[model samples]
Target: MPAASITIIFSPYHVGLRNHRVGDGPNRIRALGLIPQLEALGVTVHIDEIPPVDDFEGEIGRSFEVLRRTSLAVSKARDGNSFPFILSGNCMASVGAACGLGIKDLNFIYFDAHDDMDTPSTNENGYFDAMGLSMLAGKSWHWHTEQIPGYAPMNYKDRFLYVGLRDVNETQRKTVAEAGADVIWGDAGKAVDFPGELEKRLDKRDMSPSLVHLDLDVLDKSVGMVNGFESEGGLQEEDVMRCMSLLPKKATPVSFTMCSFNPNLGDGDKIAGIGIRAAVAFVEALIATSVVSVQQ
Candidate 1:
């Protein structure tokens, strides 16, 4: 393995949610000087911004368009052997990340407070963001998935590993169980061995490329809420770092996404700082993995 490089894809649109401030997340993260911090780690960094589309009507349509563009950008980064790190407003961008990687047998690691597995019929809030994982698994929004340039819906029934899930609904929980997806439940004040559990699962399965999706809402409120959908029982910052540290060794992390960080809802700078710390941890893990691979 050679030196690791990163391609940062900024997606500022928030069509998945009907909220006003969510769309501002990407810009806020960039404004907080994340680029310079990443560069200081001794890796080449490329920043690509997805231009906003004005013609798409409705939340679903707009989300489709934005993710389509995200797919293209991620694909380019993958082709160059540079890690794709998507900074986006909503979790649905994970679908685009999967499409861009073009790996049929990829394992998905989703870290979020919510399950994001609701289908159109089961979703009562009418939030497109809620159905992100469902769409990725080809359970809902078939029309939108087909429109994404290089996206092919994956049968991720048993390939998903969910962490920090504490705010999920009954329907979503049932769906996850029925699909046989692995989960590490979030406890209100207790810390679980997240990295150890994840490593066990990875070792049981056949080695495959992975996509790590981090939704900032998965962090406990004590860490600072980056979005409106804050949950009480969640993972601590150290737990997240631990899981990320194990990711590159347990699985080949081809792409990563840090989403749902809405800076406008809370102390903006503070929230952005927390997000930056998590991003740095992820990069450090990748760099460490690359070095080990070279030695091996």
Candidate 2:
């Protein structure tokens, strides 16, 4: 059974700027009636937004502030027994959500076109979001992560699984291999048994309720560019939903976070609609397969 209520936390900042670039995605998705749709699924909905940084902190400072705020909001929602759902412009917010879940040892099912395991030393572009997974895995950025409340890096090697990884650099590829993380490559142009693939690697006994992070760029460019980082040979909308639906069998999805969407890209409304459908599908699937109910 689903929680009696769900809290949606919106962090609408892209690289620290409010409503800028992909930062606009969170509000855009909400504007598309995501709340009503989720409520129609029979759960009370509470809304929360991460406030913008009052000062002109550098991207690093502002971004960490956003994560800190997200951590607190998600933590509050969890304390109230509400399932927390997050929408953010950058994938880094997953770390905040995980920390807020109050689980020191956690598993993650990540969907993205890129590996997101780059370190400052390895990332030539200096893209901070690229280091999200590395930070969560305790590989880089130790200085800042320690400041966030309730954060402890995990031995996330086998605990993490990657789906739709087709666009990546050699550094990212090497990191994935060295970490021994399981992956499902996207460019393999054939019908994939997503559940069968996941089941083969995931040991249910070792799993608990886990977080599901969706970087919209995991969708194929043919599905309309979800963001500037979208690549070819990605999954279709149905493929994403199918994969999400299977998660409950292996590990119940206690929380879901959708990130890295840029409404400025091709056909913003169309792309947001896909995200809306995905959110609804994820919630509905959770409801269908829910084995425990937490009343608020």
Candidate 3:
């Protein structure tokens, strides 16, 4: 592993509320020893917190503010040639992280339980988080999304990889299909080769920096529930660790993020520990990949 440094940008806000519900997950996971574990490997790790806003805006206003702050932090980290690691309450932070890394020609690898593809008109539940992937694909929320610093709607084409989908609605399924994304369903009855699928897609494209985003709810309930939205048939812990190790082999991951963890829920500490371990695994994979690159 080459000598490297990382900047961890954590947002302890869920839907713009500080330490509310899932917002606590980031701090909790960090407290669980994510930083010390990385430092043990002799990796330099810097910590940055998203500044809490004084004005009381609604969820929509606050959420975008969080994203804007996140983008700035991410850009600063990348400017220093440090890897950006985001720990946020909402998976939508991926937009800010990607934009900060410069969105032009950037590829995305998404791991989530839900499709997160509902548009404003299509989302009956009125859940803002559900529309994250849709916004990334430039399918919805044009006005608000444009407000986010460094944010531009993502170009899906062949550069998008959606994995561990098991609880998507019909509308989300249709939306994802129309985008022509490569998907690996979590509920497939047959065995899955996570690395093989990732490599196959990566082989089709020129090597470019990628953002790897993991929503903790992608883990199965049996592994310990990560949030209220967790369902029965999601990926197991071993499956997630294996995928984390293999993703860096083909994709040059410039940034990594884990979101959608609600520590207020049952067994929060257990899930936080799992998330911390996965994060450590990802950094180790990055180190190993970098060493191999240097060797060649």
Best by lDDT: 2
lDDT (Cα, tens digit) per residue for candidate 3, span 1-296: 34258889988888888888888889889888889987776678889899886475799888888888888999998777778899998888887897788768888888888878888889887778888777766788778778777877777777778777778777778878888777877764555555566667677775457888999988877788687887766777887887888788777888899999888778889988889888878888888887222112
Q: What is the lDDT of residue 131 in candidate 1?
A: 86
Q: Give model 3's clash tally.
A: 0
If ranked by TM-score, best first, what sequence of candidates would result?
2, 3, 1
Candidate 1 vs candidate 3: which has greater TM-score? 3
Compared with the true structure, model 1 gives a TM-score of 0.92
Tens-digit lDDT track for model 1 on 1-296?
54347889988778843334777887888888899898887778888888767778777778888889999999887677678999988788988988888888888888888888899899988778898878877888898798887777786656888888888778878988987778888877777677777788888885457788999888887878678788777877787878777777777777889988778765678877777888887787778777322112
Query: Which segments of model 2 are wrong by more than 4 Å?
Result: 188-196, 199-206, 291-296
Clashing pairs in 3: none
Comparing candidate 2 with candidate 3, which one achieves the higher TM-score?
Answer: 2
Whichever of 2 and 3 has more lDDT, that candidate is 2
Identify the leading candidate in terms of TM-score. 2
By lDDT, rank the candidates, best first.
Answer: 2, 3, 1
RMSD of each: 2.8, 2.2, 2.8
Give the per-residue lDDT digits (tens) of candidate 2, residues 233-252.
78888888777667776687
